[model samples]
Target: MRWLMLLFCLGLAACQPRPVKELPAVSASQSVAELYRLEREHHALSALADVTVTRQGKRWSVTQGVVIERPLRLRVDAINFLGQTLFQMGIDGPLLQAYVPAEKKFYTGMATLDNVQRFTGLPLALPDLVACLLYSLPPGVVESAQIIETAQGVDLVLAPGVRYETVFSSGRLSGFRYRIDDLTLYEVAFGPVSAELDFPRRIELDVPQSDTRVVIALDDIELNPVLSRQQFQLSLPATAEEVPLNEMEPVDDQTVEH
Candidate 1:
């Protein structure tokens, strides 16, 4: 019986995958209009704020400060709890120049700029993506919104490529579960986190298969404020290592290993 129990546990662990859920159905056109209207009413702005991202079962987490100056400039300063800066980047219009002050090293590359912009989860940029996430969107819409919902929330089986099972409400986002859309259990439960602002203040992502979880919270939002050009300037540390964005080669690994 003990051997059987151990086998069962192993089987379960091997069977688990990421989490993903889908919504029922809604008028995509109408939903888009509503989301756009919300942005206009809120008057989105370029600003900076503190961010914290946590994963499942881990007491240690990631804390960072993100600054956005608009049209296309983002600087993410990631640090540990000790107030030590881990990584910093100066993004000027799609260019990601990351520098490590302590290590005296830097790397330049192209990043998922569009993804970051679309999913700001903040009140920056003209068409806010977080607002869209709350509303119903067309599935396969814009090639990025993997899931869309018009009706009932969703239930997802765990599998590879699984996303989170999320239910958008008028309050804080919660019960965020992630698994493959095809494998999630037939039924799931969810509750609102808290609805203080138009955007999601808190989001809970659950991954039963991998036993992984993610919690995201947003605060200190400066909606639709004026920004100056100086904010986007790349203030590189003196004597720190530097690399040109074009110096790095493409990541096609089918060739020889450099």
Candidate 2:
């Protein structure tokens, strides 16, 4: 039921990520070395979060249980204010699956970036997906990173393939942009890192292309928690209507409340 509203709002607008810039030629200094250390800081994560999705000035949210591991394993369960399980979505390797309890429908598809964009309004591939959640860069990105030292802080830039700058103000981790070629895909702003857990307390994601935003406030985070195989597993139930992810077209907005 809650997800239904989110799906509707999604069709109204589009993924509205923040602005990203093209790559500039700058050399790395000791300042950029710090970025390398950020890579692979966490191999696994388990947490509970207040996940809010926004579109066209409309907001919807859910209490989400999140589990993620390296090499593309993920699980997310959305629970509403009434403690009802609204939906469940997960990824294992290249496989994607989701289930809606109210509709008794299950969705399945390949775990590609486009599918990710369609499902969560985030334009990220599996590896980069983990990077966004863990606040780390993809493997070897730092090796090819450039630097722009500002009076405020350092701006780390990447090469053509993925051209985005990671901003650090006053020697602290702030956030970054994500881009493909010349197009800015999205932007992320990070919250204060929890000294207790070494993990960020909140993450704000924007997809400017579609005007969509997502805010995740993480709580009770466990770094590298032991996750069971069953957590990433989902079976199509015989009673549920099996729907492929590609088939879930955006509903015509003429029928929705403007």
Candidate 3:
């Protein structure tokens, strides 16, 4: 009799309807161009991030400040916990310059994709880095984009083998995944929104290929601040040794070759 009762209860439970998950509505007519425009409008101009970088089992927690003048200009300064400037790097068009005050050495090289990756541990072009920092898509023409409804939110698959899966909550972008093929290039998550700019107060970038991760917490982040071209310049003393960026090794044993 107990077995018969259990069988009846199981049959009744199986007949009940399962709760359905409602996904966010995505427009079928949405184009990549529209999304790009939206992203550009929301991009920040200059930001000062308290960054923590972890790479290859080593960690460097520093305060980094970055200024971006779109179309191809960037400057970054990293200061250690004791408030000593560790390094300063600038990217002007195709030229890349970096100054290490500790070593009193200045390095210059072409800002190629590979070179930037070797130095920054980010496998992306300069423009791509700017976009990522601003929580926007890279500046380019997408051959096609497909919008699909996902359990998390909406996914936009761009042409040339790139995928962006976005998660939205409370009508704001919470995070996203940048993927190439089956490999995830970067995973970006946004923290609480700033009351002033409506932008995220914190952003996290995780790079799985090189085991690198960067967490940026913003303070006094200015959007579209007036910046002069001179701010991007890196000046070195006459006595400072000049070295080609490709030949400059972070350590004596590790050499990065072009």
Instruction: Name the best candidate (by lDDT).
Output: 2
lDDT agreement of model 1 with the native: 0.43
Sort the candidates on lDDT, descending order. 2, 3, 1
User: What overall lDDT goes with each candidate model?
Assistant: 0.43, 0.73, 0.71
TM-score of each: 0.49, 0.76, 0.79
1-258: candidate 2 lDDT, tens digit per residue? 999999989977676775785432333354466566566567889999887777667766668888988868988887877889877888988999988787798989888776655545454678877777877766656666675665433554675456666676545567877777767788888899877787789999888876768889999899988888789978887889998877876522211111
Pairwise lDDT winner, candidates 1 and 3: 3
Among all windows of 10 consecutive residues in model 3, the one with the lowest summed lDDT is: 249-258
Candidate 3 off by > 4 Å:
1-15, 18-21, 25-34, 117-123, 141-144, 250-258
By summed lDDT, the worst window of 10 consecutive residues in model 2 runs over 249-258
Between candidates 1 and 2, the one scoring higher on TM-score is: 2
Per-candidate RMSD, Å: 14.1, 17.4, 4.6
Tell how far residue 175 is off in model 3, in angstroms.
1.8
Candidate 1 lDDT by residue in tens digits, 76-123: 566666888776665566555666666586666554433232122222
